[model samples]
Target: MMSTATAIQERSLLGLKHLSREDILAILDRASYWEQQSEKLVPILNKKFAVNMFFENSTRTRFSFEMAQKRLGVQVMNFTAAASSVEKGESIYDTVRTLESMGVDAGVVRLKPSGVLQELAQRVRIPLINAGDGNNEHPTQALLDLYTMRKVFGELQGLTVSIIGDIKHSRVARSNLWALQKLGAKVQFCAPSVMSAPELAEHAPYVSMEEALKADVVMMLRVQLERHSGGLFQSSEEYREQYGLTEERAASLLGHTIIMHPAPVNRNVEIDDAVVECDRSYIFRQMAHGVPVRMAVMERAMRD
Candidate 1:
């Protein structure tokens, strides 16, 4: 009979919504162990090959997954839409099937369309990890973000987390809402009227920027200028004054309150440069935690 962990290995991690609270905790506990030994490479994934198939461009997520794979002794195959046969109009199913034929044991995929990863998972035999799928979810990122919060507060129950900005187009926000709420954290969404989604408001109530900044964790999201059509906000300066985490706003938060952002920040647009480096900011630490959390996920997906 297969153990629970072994059963997890056979399943595709398309979203956090599919995981139980115990499963989420198990991943976090495993991540904590990896965090303690992050500087040392492990052979947990020795002799395995994992392919990275990213249809959308990314910096932090792509590199962190590659680092996690290498640190665990897995051979990395990097694939980009521009360089791959995807340019020749090949389907995602064909691309993944080709990689599988080459003995790729697992894959981390990021696509611009929602639910495509889940569709691909049905056709693929190996475990599929969703890096980010459109405006749907980024499950691993939510895991890392949860890990960061747990590291700081030592618990997630009853804690308040306010996710600010670009909620309509943010996969991070979608993932975090589900994961955080499942772990007993109260989540609130704060965004420009145009950027707020009614669907998310059903999970987390929409709060004003002032109310959101007062939470225990203030997570500012990128404005996602590329994803938006036209005129979401009236002006950059107006948005900053109303919603951005400026130096003054960050300073006003109690010392116990922490500021966070999923990066490639717009500098002064969503968050001020000074606020990102402020004493209460955990923005960079969040990035540091990404490797170990992802390492935990990879280990779980490939465990025998």
Candidate 2:
């Protein structure tokens, strides 16, 4: 006979590949309960250890993981691009081998290039949660964002969601689209053709920002400076006029559309400052939920 924890333990949430629509709903149901009671709950991960191995510069995602782990009493080993020998010589696989030798348990990782997390998933027997991997996915961020949406609007099905900007270089864009589609939201992309998802992303991306903004939710992602291998556009001014969310455009769609951005936002480049601060905005809530959601991820991993 399986204990409740044992049932969850035998299940591995290694990838979206393993999750059904029902599985995601169950995770969300659990996350919502945790979000409400997290402050009252005793630290569960006390003495257990987790590691953060990031290959990028981040504010919300990195610190959120640390806070989440700490809140659960999980000891954390933090490593960034600068602090480690990743600067001089060692490969990522070698770096993980080194960490494994240190007795770290499960780790949450952020890296560049699509499919890198999949590679790491194979390499590490310990559960590896994907933070952000190039323009491929940010699973945890998507989870938090979806939780926010459900809290604000009550349901996702049939609601229009516009994910705007840098889709070609944003893991958030890809992950959000995946989650939104799975939950029955009508998802669309707003970007220059070059910055849009590749042909296989299903929906034909809108070249005109205005066309995509007619959504119940407008989610803007920051441009990925590090991954823009080529200048997607010739000039910032031209880019702003054509595709950027200007004040004029904001006023046009200003009423009830919930505006969101997965930080850090390139203000005036992808979104108008006023819109980001508007009452309709959920940017900060999205950031705030990061801690609880990551806590949920860590808890589930440890239970497994």
Candidate 3:
């Protein structure tokens, strides 16, 4: 039999823009299959080795990918920049090439630079999955978000999803905007003037917070304070008043409208604490769906 690592030598998942509508649906279908097989651990990736190389810090994306690998029976190596020679000025290309030389089948990479993942993809021979790349994209998160919505609504067409807050600094928002639009969902952006991006006007029109709340789905983005230099907002209190999903706002939404956040929630800043636990909130459920969606991605990436 061909070695497991060799089977995935030709595949890499860089971004949602690389996938077709049919490709997106097939991955979702695969995720559903994995979800149904939850209780049983299937070892389709037995004897394969994959590495998680996170140049950026993450909790959900990193651990979920690790969990998906373990559940699929793939041996995993975790690489952190601080712990690796990356701290000694080793380039990403050299580091990943070293992993490739070690016979790893695939790599899941999260980097802080926008186009670095694609650059690394070109240099590496094994399959490389982009976990998140700066403000460029987070394809897997978008896929899982879509999968979570599909579980609830059965279809994406005609559903309106309003993404509120920090649009200029969100990889999640960019990925979701592309995927949701391609899947026939109407998307809108709502954010403070400082946080809005000119590019967003091409994909979705900006709407008032009240107008945004009328959508079937409300996705609140955290204030990306780390990525911003300064002056995005004067105060968190003011941001909460204008853009936060307050308890009153959540309560006022239609019964069927749902709430979402790509998490690391800002408590009362981007979304009210109480609103996060409300019946309409599917934030945690979205985290739960990450494993299966990642499983589907890894399985397909490693397939012959």
Candidate 4:
């Protein structure tokens, strides 16, 4: 019950690999239309059942999905590790099967181990949608991020974007890289050697922070403080010197460039406080799209 996905799971989505480039564009296009809709949110997901199985904690993404599903009238059954049988030795595979037997149409999962979700999807009768899987992928977040970019920049192809910060541990980085690449954007990574994303090197040929900032878009990723290990850095100052996006660095970027970020920003660590208040920053817009992007995800996944 781990690693690669199978036909059972292929019935849902484990990564973006199952979908074609055109399928990706179609999802975004539909998400845009949903974003413009009115108060009939509750009617959309009616009669459908979606289970939220999160091994890790999340507020924005989880709540956003719940809200979107509720808006669409889908029945949601939420399960968190703290309050679920997971604490009592109920394996993820078993839990998935138990829920599937109850007629759950789809399961939205967010787990810490990469690719574990695909295992669950492969065996389940229901469709599977990954919320976030360790540092592997968070396709929904990427979708919303892409949706936001298209809304602001009007296109993603040829746009240059720098994704800066804890690339080694950030699922956000992994997902965004693929999402941006599929859309034809030039993406760059900027992180400390310890925090640097070797995993991303396979996807990005160009990995310079300075060059990435020269592009049309730059996303500041938060430093994951809770997960940081000892000896990875000599000092916070040193880390900042090598990797932090200070106010001065922000100013050095192109004037017309838009600043982006996925939530829970660590003010002085990955991004300067000044940049959050910057007119060019669209971090907030990313959150706003979470609702609609998820709406599209749920709708498409649950479609009969």
Candidate 5:
């Protein structure tokens, strides 16, 4: 017997910021179940239609959600802003309303403007999953990240995760911060002063790059140079030298420490090429785990 509040909450994943510890764990547990399945396709969601509306460009998140939907046998409609009426100045809300009118069961969305997803969720009739909403949050990414950590450590309790690089512009950092702390994991940030989020200083301490490497998980975010105004650093090489996970820095990490990055990696910018595929790096594993985690999320969104 699910309460009305619980039913609504489970139907849409706007972000992990509001999810309780039990809610987070339940998603992880379900993801583990999906990963264990030997069947290539479950088809439990056959005939259910989902729309992926990407107002912004994406590689991993877009494809991952599509794969997750397909695995469950949900019919998928992918909408790219560049190819749609959005280019002719249609409001995001109008575009969504048009799709909802077409009888979509769910919408997985990514957009450049912050706080708009909340408005959409309020207005839309169908369930909506936040693929990303500006720099506010990327709920599914954080969920997958948590799943990856849980797989390695067996639990989230007592784990220390340091998220390094571009904190001020990272939705991933914010999502991870809220969700990890709720699950009893320690969350820390390591970023240059210019890239640090002053709003979050009260929540997690910003550590130096050297100190950040000691955590159970060292998650490196993309440098996001396109978002910067002027020169944050003189060059990518300099950013690498200062904040990037160089081979030397990677060597100093604890034996139990694991490296991570939510990629579109910068090659040698935020992390060295040598360390990208190193035994301790979980970047690829993170991408691999995104499938099942999202499958769990899609199932939850459409589940009765």
Candidate 6:
């Protein structure tokens, strides 16, 4: 029989919603192996080719994937909607298919639609990785987040993680919630009624801001104001008082608790500038850990 881990290795990473605990740990274990290597470049995948198709704007995720690919000696191609034939009305499938026809071994994709990635995964022969897909999931980001958390707490079996902010539109929150729970951590959400995802209530409960700060990890999400229409909050200042990680809230967290954010953070909006680089903040560390986690992911994607 093909083992579950073997089965997992053969597929595209669409989301973490269906990933098992063992599968997640295996990837994290691989990430740890990559992190410990002293060599700056490992030519394990010297001749392989991979293309990054991003229909949306991004910085960290895109750059991290590029760095990870180069370290493994993979030939990389970058595609953005604004610069590609996509701007002339080419469909996403056509763009990916075009790239696949050009001899790419795998694809790392980020787009604005929710269900399109799953559909693309089925249509494409090369392994497809979900970088971010609307409000659906950002599996690699969650894996790195899990990697960071494990480094601190040593295990996820009983850790408490509170994800606070624009939950309705956050792929980060969805990805973290699914991955965290599968690894035995308790996950909770704290978003204003307008910002909460009604569909997620069955998986995790929404809590008060005061209650959220008490967790072993307080993950403040980026408040996606561009995704909001109107009547969400009076202004950024108001959101700061109610939902942002203000200095007062940081002071109230338990001594062992750590602060995290999936960055491109609105410094004074979703989190205060002072608390961003404070002792307990792992915001930047998360960025550093991303390279290894994604290196593991890209390596796995190209494996037969």
Q: Which candidate is the best by lDDT?
A: 5
Compute each candidate's TM-score over C-alphas.
0.95, 0.88, 0.95, 0.92, 0.97, 0.96
Candidate 1 lDDT by residue in tens digits, 1-304:
8755446445568898877888899889999999899367898788899999999999789999999899999989899999988999999899999998889888999999998888788777789999999999999989999999999999999999999999989999998988898899999999878889998777899988889988999999988565655766557777788889998898878779998888878889889988888788888999999999999989887766
lDDT winner, 2 or 6: 6
User: After superposing candidate 6, which stretches have Cα over 4 Å from the reference?
Assistant: 1-9
TM-score of 1: 0.95
Q: Compared with the true structure, what per-residue lDDT tens digits does model 3 show for residues 182-253?
A: 999999999877788888798799999999999999999989555555776667887898889999999889
Q: TM-score of predicted model 3?
A: 0.95
Candidate 1 least-lDDT 10 residues: 3-12
Please identify which of the two predictions, 5 or 6, would achieve the higher lDDT against the true structure.
5
| Each prediction's whole-model lDDT (CA) | 0.88, 0.75, 0.89, 0.80, 0.92, 0.92
Q: What range of 10 consecutive residues in model 3 has the weakest lDDT sum?
A: 2-11
Q: What is the lDDT of candidate 6?
A: 0.92
Q: Give the residue spans of candidate 2 off by over 4 A.
A: 1-18, 38-41, 201-207, 224-234
Instruction: Kindly report which residue pairs in candidate 4 clash with one another.
Output: 9-121, 9-122, 41-71, 44-72, 45-72, 45-73, 45-74, 46-73
Error of 5 at 184 (Å): 0.8
* Candidate topping TM-score: 5
Give the local distance difference test score of model 3. 0.89
Kindly list the per-residue Cα lDDT of model 5 for residues 1-304, writing each as its tens digit: 9865556556999998888888899999999999999997999999799999999999789999999999999999999999999899999999999999999989999999999998888877788999999899999999999999999999889999999999999999999999999989999999988899999999999998888989999999999676675857878888999999999999999999999888878999999999999999999999999999999999999976
Q: lDDT winner between 2 and 3, please give it.
A: 3
Candidate ranking (lDDT, best to worst): 5, 6, 3, 1, 4, 2
Candidate 4: worst-modelled 10 consecutive residues by lDDT: 2-11
Clashing pairs in 1: none
